[model samples]
Target: MTNKTFCVVCKRDDASVIDMQPHLVRCLQCGAYEIMAIEYLQMTNQEQDPLLSAWIRNRTEEQASPPLLTSSTWISLRASLRIPNLREKQAALMKAFARRSMFPGTVGRYNPVADFPLAWAANEGELRFLKQDLIARQLLDNEYTMGGSFLITAKGWDYLDSIPAGGVFSDQVFVAMSFSDTMRTAWTSAIIPAVRQAGYTPYRVDAAPHIDRIDHKIMVEIKASRFLIADVTEQRAGVYFEAGYALGQELPVIWAVREDDLKNVHFDTRQYAHIVWKNERELEKGIYETIVAVIGRGKSH
Candidate 1:
């Protein structure tokens, strides 16, 4: 059974709380997420509500359930969650249609008010801008109206087709991690296998074949790959740099750190969630779960 109540995350009244161990909430605005009673009581993320709300909204992927947020995940996600840029949001909206449409030219009408979060917009007006831009770019129908059917154009189909298929070209994932002698076992046993298990090829720049200037090559590899995993165990400046570059490219980043070393993570980035692990086994589980949650299972999964 589900009980109606205001959402703890978004404070929206249309939320239904499932009667269970860890409270499971389904909110019209924030989608569905599971939170522990203890974690809820200890929550300190009130200061960053907007970002958290938007993050929850975006997690309502095609059919995936919302991720479980313990004390650990909430902090990492809160620290790293950012409002996507306009172009990124536009792409997301189109990709959504591409994935959800049954066939080409399938007519769809999404509510600008109720579905604004689908495009990561703050309000209906921002979502209107997205539809307007798509209409102008010939990605959507040319009609101008407030509430009506929205259709993806033939050009939109062609555009989505031009994107990489079969996850063929972008299956590689760049790993930004320390090469510390202490981390070798974790690298080989934990991170690499976890990525491969998730169906992505992991490429650590250090292990890749490269002839260009090291710095330039790192950036090139990052740009050509899918997402990146950043482990800041040793506080390496290079790891931070690569992670920042990937963020600039608007790629998903799964952050991880050794539990013992987590306290040393930079103050600016400590807010973002990092899979803090005391052992390689914990690290592997956290990394795999996070990859599935943030970017969905890769081609291999």
Candidate 2:
């Protein structure tokens, strides 16, 4: 009889007498999608090598389910913020949050940045918890302190900059969204027609071309275009990279994602204003709305 072991996710080690093959486990504790024997060995031996230890830690954290903010902790922080001195301390902590270096023995007090530890220690655990939360949210740097004031990290600042005024988007719009293979084909076919109908020349950049010599031409064409229409399905890395390039150039770019894949999008991309659709009707409606909201305001691409 073949030896059998339980899967980490299922936690069932018993091998059926009829079928004794080893099975992978899925660990609910960590929300790991699949836990193979090889992965288990890697995890167990991560500490043997310093490089592997760091790599494993990063991978594990990345794959682990997101942590939820504790209600009690949130309430405590909110109440503490109401205190006059604590309010100032919280402000100081926020200002210092993004700095990469810290002075020991300082935090909320004036000139506290001179002694980082003092400021951190003075806040007790509440400030520490709040700081950690900010780091997790990408609102602050994990290891940063400046002369007792907290600063937003570059990433945090970029995120803040991405938000349009009054939450009313004006630079980007969704011109198309499709999910099924049929829908995708139809949307692709309609793109040129739709843009033309909108009184704009239909300049296109085929984002999903096979790796070939034509890739250069595609890029050149995109660069020459006055506006961008990005299709973000299957999470194509190239599509996302190109979309970002257009955005950086201050071009008006429309973001369209498949409705079924909305939950699978990365946090950075999902946070941005976007349109999602699953069918042709939804796509048309979404595009019209985006046109009226972002393109109609005389915002130049």
Candidate 3:
């Protein structure tokens, strides 16, 4: 075996450096402070890496079974990983593992942009930071060599399990619609009331005072909402972008379009089931049913 220092968390050897005289090293990639082999061995005969050993023991108990891909627990776990910080990238990496492990015959490497579009790094430095944060948190296993993939540990799964699926903003529903007078009126008179009946608070951008950074406000709302309702009646580019962003975050999105404008819905989004309505009443009814089905009954107020 090659003698090298690696993060006890994200086993990558590249970013770790000797921190003390003996048996102590810190991984800059994932921010893991670990005891070296000699000290680790002296402390416990169970294994050189206690964290890895526990994970192995757990896996062996279950016959090395793969993660449950279809369980709600798994869905929530994956969705919760999309944090706003470097943890988002780390979660995406773990999600990639869960996804790959689900399909037996599938073979390919993880592509940050393709698999983790929401948390894709802008540059190598950002990617490095993300990996480092994951390692430091002990959520990811370290790689022993360059270009090696890291694995999620038992602690990682435990951490994910502790995160609530819907979180605090689970009852907030964001509306992405045209900013026309007719649309605004429909939202206030019809959509808002229907959303209220369905137990979710409907939020529209226009409700806020206009600011120079409107897009930033929209993004913040999108992140804060449990789901999004995108009205593509006018084929607004912004609505499409908002919906795409929600999808990237693994948030549920309800697509809506006027019956007359249905033909103009973007081809890329046309495949998804959309609520086609002729009037405000029809839109309200359709949206209400969709919301209940997607998110279940909202918290009783």
Instruction: TM-score winner between 1 and 2, please give it.
Output: 1
Clashing pairs in 1: 76-272, 76-273, 77-273, 79-271, 79-272, 80-272, 199-300
lDDT, ranked from best to worst: 1, 3, 2
Question: lDDT tens string, model 3, 81-161?
Answer: 322445544554444454444343223244432222222343345555676677677766555211434456567667655
User: Which ranges in model 2 have alpha carbons more than 4 Å from their true place?
Assistant: 1-183, 188-190, 206-212, 297-301
User: Root-mean-square deviation of each candidate, in angstroms?
Assistant: 15.2, 19.5, 16.5
**Pick by lDDT: which candidate is best?**
1
- lDDT value for model 3: 0.59
Positional deviation of residue 274's Cα in model 2 after best superposition, in angstroms: 1.3
- Which stretches of model 1 miss by more than 4 angstroms? 41-50, 70-72, 144-148, 164-301
* Backbone clashes under 3 angstroms, per model: 7, 31, 13
Write one digit per residue (lDDT tens) for candidate 2, span 113-182: 1222222223235556555666687666556533334556666556544633211211222222234475
In candidate 3, residue 185 scores what lDDT?
A: 61
**Cα deviation of 94, candidate 1, in Å:** 1.0
Using Cα atoms with residue i matched to residue i, what is each candidate's TM-score against the true structure? 0.54, 0.35, 0.48
| lDDT (Cα, 0-100) at 120 in candidate 1 | 71
